[model samples]
Target: MDVSSTLVFAGIILVLLWLFSVNNSSKHRLPPGPRALPLIGNLPQIDSNAPFKSITKFSETYGPVVTLYVGRQRTVALFGYDVVKEALVDQGDDFTGREQLPFMLKATRGYGLGISNGERWRQLRRFTLTTLRDFGMGRKGMEEWIQEESQHLEAHIRSLKGQPFEPTFLLGCTVSNVICCLVFGERFNYEDKQFLRLLNIFTEFIRFNTSTMGQLYAIFPWFIERLPGHHHTVFAQMDEVREFIKKKIQEHKETLEPNSPRDYIDCFLIRMNQEKDNPSTEFIYDNLVSTVMNLFFAGTETTSTTMRYALSALIKYPEIQEKMRQEIDTVIGQNRCPNMEDRKSLPFTDAVIHEVQRFLDIVPFSVPRYTLKDISFRGYTIPKGTTILPMLHSVLREEKQWASPWSFKPEHFLDQNGNFKKNPAFLPFSAGKRNCVGESLARMELFLFLVSLLQHFTFSCSEGPDSINLVPEYSGFANMPRMHDIIATPR
Candidate 1:
């Protein structure tokens, strides 16, 4: 066949596939959603920039549980805390499947804990959780790690001498170094060129993933991959990060001590050997490399971005910042670094941090879940292979859940007695068995880093608080807070 003939053939194949998908979906009592086109599905209806907003709007018309298609992929989005909690928390196992988006598949090459399902996911997740806990993931040892890192962060800021600087990469360095200490067993210097390069890659990775082009790429990767665009550049940079991880694995192997495992890499290397003979063992070379990549990527970007947003939030609401500082001074004083033990004594400070996470709603759409098999949810049949989206944004911002769903109010997490209160709907880390593995660590970092920063410096931008917008610049894959150059004046 000539090129034109081949193109026609491919087009016909896609039509047939889309028709088959529609025919099957019609057979089942799928949830109601907006009308969709044949090949493109509901793309025309969606705001490509903020795809979740489109999904949320669909829920307003179709009720809480609604279905839509994105480039022929059927998706059922659960809105509100009740419905999302029922699916992800109530029927957790059925919603445990992680959708391996083409973007993630390309990033991990189909071999990581972040984008795997079934036995692979279970094995790696169990092992990862166990190993991380052993290395003090959410425990006292990790608290010390964060406390020490806080000092380093504070020192770096003090060296700035109150000059205005964008906190994006500097905060990335701070957060990434903590995960580096856990995974690689060492921290990178703030000025390391390669370290800075890796951090930039992570920032770009999040930026692209949250862009409109990135959304299109996820929905129609087969077509997008064939065409030239920014996606290619993002993927290439991702490969560089992956290659960097592989090199680190090699170094760990060379310096391995079976009896004295230095960090996560050493521990995994030891496990890989113990299971080298077992065919079913998930502890293998590819998994180790990919899981490390998963850890590095997840452990670095999300927490760092949250901290970045937290700084923006603080700058935007200096009153909240001052209140938190007062609480910090009273509870922990300025003599020593803030610790997790100080959280209870510092209720207002704790409330502000929790409120920050809740208001930001960073991961608005929890990593899309997949139905591994036919399942019944809310009297509807979610057919196997359908993507499930528990809209964390709706839950976090649900009118019925919060007194001020849209505003940044620390009192949302506070009681009439002025003690810190826990809200079931405050799911910034999400809720479920498949929720963020690094939740505890992220919490520790936010508290320690923010408290430490406020202890020494008052955050304000040159453009003034009025110029700082708490609204994220992008709102798709993640809610990315607008970046600003701000001064950290010595307190």
Candidate 2:
């Protein structure tokens, strides 16, 4: 058939598909939402730049649980604290299926832990958690790793000689090194050219994923893949990352010692051999490569971005910075590097760090979850294959949850007695069984790196506190803080 004939034929099929969807949706009692167009459903109603904010506005009309669409994909978004909690936490298993995002599917070639479900997800996640724990993920050995990295970070800053510099890459290197030690079994020098290139790829991947082009690719993969755009560069860089991981795996294979697993890669290699006899096993080379990609990318960007944003928070609030410094000095003192043991004694500093994560609600929309089978939630029957978004931004900023939900107040994580208190609503790593696998590691890095920085330096900017905006530079995939050139004067 010619192009025009194919176009006409495709149009007829789309009309039929949309009609079938509308009819089935009613029969399934899908949640109520705004009216949608045939092919492009609710995409027109959303702000392409920041879809979550636009979706939040939809909650104003449709109440808490509502159905919407991006193109032909039917999506149910759970808003507010109670409803989100009901689905993600209270009814966790039913909603545990991870959506294979088009971009991620392309990056991982539909392999790996980050986007896998069913037996694959269970096997990888279980093995990953167990191996990470064995390697001191949240324990004293991990604390020592961070404490040593803390000194390296401090030295890098001191070399700046109080001159103004953007903390994005430096913080990226610091946080990336901690994860590197866990995964690769060694840390790269701060000045290494190749190490910096890898971190830069992580940042670019994040930036592209949040860009308009990224959303376009996710919603219309077939068309976007054919056309020339920024998405192409992203995939290329991702391939470069994959190649790097593959090379590292080869080297680890040469130096393999099953009795003494050096890091995550070594442990995974050992597991791969143990499961080599089983046909149903998920511990294979493809998984090792992709899972490492997942760990490296997720491990590097999220924590490092949080660290960079943490500094932006301090730069914006010098008083808060000084207060944290005082707490660090009083508790841990300036003579030694800050450790996890010092957290309880440094309540105010701890509160400030928690507040920073909350105020800058990174990953505003948790990674999308899908319904693997027909499921009923909140008296509504949602059919299988529907997408679910438990909007973390809504939960974090829910009016009923915090006294000043929109403000950057450290007291949100503090008590009347001035001790650090935990808030169930503070979910930067998200919640439930499918929550961040690197939560403990990220926490340790945040505490040690921030405390160490606060201990040695009093951060400020020439533009003054009034100039620093707590709002993110980008608002989609992640809430990235605005980068600023600030001076870190040694205390």
Candidate 3:
């Protein structure tokens, strides 16, 4: 053979050998998953249309811990309670980090508690827990706040005067007001223009984050950052929320009486000053803004959406609604607003709320986490820095955990004696170190507001031949019910 021909032949052999070695190496390290084409990974498999349901399908085929590639990065998706619990709790410290998406990094500058991990996460999380406790989250003082807000919510609903109205705005007002009381030390009137704008921004941001575009941004942040899309709108809304929080912080700073901390912002400003000289302190204006935003983001939407579903379920099943109404009337009289303390005495009400959370599963797949170090789970080695998407929806619907996993049966939360029974699978607030910090507050709000509303009004579907659709329409980051009107008749 000629010299040129021999050279080309040797090059071809070397290239083939390298490709073979690379493919074999990937087979050993990567978890079993459906085949994917180059560059796209399993993006085609994802019904960008309904990613949550699509991921659930993948779980069924690939087992609880399925690995998928988004662009060049591979992520481990843990479905079901056993796998999710094992990764999030058993190896908690090893998987506590968060993936830094471009928009979030730009918005938070790597300061917020929700996405920040390691030392920053430790300090901020500890301080937040302590502050919330001091503010009476699980105590009587916070319960009083919830009770007051519940009354406000009930009064607003009563103003509907048996008209067929959508409960979205009222529920949003009630949930947002609870956070407002916590952060700003007061509640906003239902008609407050500024508060309404903030709520609108929040709703938009949530919708954007749960869209296919949001997933694309997370995967290809560099490319998405420069492009104009809903992702940009999300970033803009984030800035608006942050600026509003900053203005509130400034107002608090100017009116500061150091000895007396009035609200979350007041307490945070005091901490920032106290830790001003500490180089490692995560307490600052940026962190404060992000923390307040986090509270608003986490607290408002999830609770309100759950309440919306709860009421919709009640409207669909008038029998359950009447039963719940009777339970409320019998347990707590209608003379005054229902209190958090009344939850224990009202088992059916509590069970109904719990069932709503479980069945709706607002956050189908929670905010994703990253493995901080090499960890082994169920005979699979999850490498450090690998993203973990825990399918919380699977846990909420796990057959092993509940008898009727797919139904809206309140009996799942009620024992044979007709008392509220705590199920280990009821992990709507999630579990482990990253378990919801505002869980107690959320519970108090849901219980007090739901029971209070029921006390004042009995929700029913408006006069229509079509029945209320219980199926949820996927939106942003929550599984929200389709827009429907309810007739809130006075009980």
Model 3 agreement with the true structure over 1-491: per-residue lDDT tens digits: 99999988986786666455436437445566777545556788777766777777887788888888666566788888888898788988777777775556776767778788888888889988898888888778888887887777767777777778887877898888877877888899999988888888777766666677776776778878888877777787778888888888889989999999988889888989999999988897888888788887777888888888888888877888788889989988789877777888989889999998998888787777887777777887777767788888889999999999989899998989999999977888888889899999888888888888888887777564247777776643567677788887886
Q: How far is candidate 3 from the true structure (C-alpha RMSD, Å)?
A: 4.9
Q: Across residues 1-491, which tens digit of lDDT does each residue of candidate 2 receive?
A: 99999999999999899989888888898888999999899998998778899999989998899899889899999888788778878999998999989999999988999999999999999999998888899999999998898899889899999999998888888888887888899999989998888889888888888888888888889988999988898899999999999999999999999999999999999988998999999999999999999999998888888888888888888788888887787787889877788899988989998988888889888899999999999889988999999899998899899999988999998999999999888777878889999999999889988888888888888889889887787877778778888899998
Q: Give the winner by lDDT: 1 or 2.
A: 1
Give Cα distance to truth, residue 355, candidate 3, Å: 0.6
What is the C-alpha lDDT profile of model 1 across 1-491, one tens digit per residue? Answer: 99999999999998999888888888788989988887999989888778888889998889999999988889899999999899988999999999988888998889989989999999999988988999999899998998888888889999999999999999999999999999999999999999999999888988888998888889889878999899999999999998999999999999999999989999999998998899999998888888999999899998888888888888889898988888888887788887788888989998988888888888889999999999999899999999999999999999999999989999998899999999998888778899999988898888888888888899999888999988789998899898899999998
Clash totals for all models, in order? 0, 0, 1
- For each candidate, give its TM-score against the true structure: 0.98, 0.98, 0.92
**Which sections of candidate 2 miss by over 4 Å?**
1-6
lDDT of each: 0.90, 0.89, 0.80
Show model 1 residue runs off by greater than 4 Å.
1-13
- The count of backbone overlaps in candidate 2 is 0
Best by lDDT: 1
Residue 236, candidate 3: alpha-carbon lDDT: 79
Model 2 pairs whose backbones collide = none
Off by over 4 Å in 3: 1-28, 101-103, 463-466
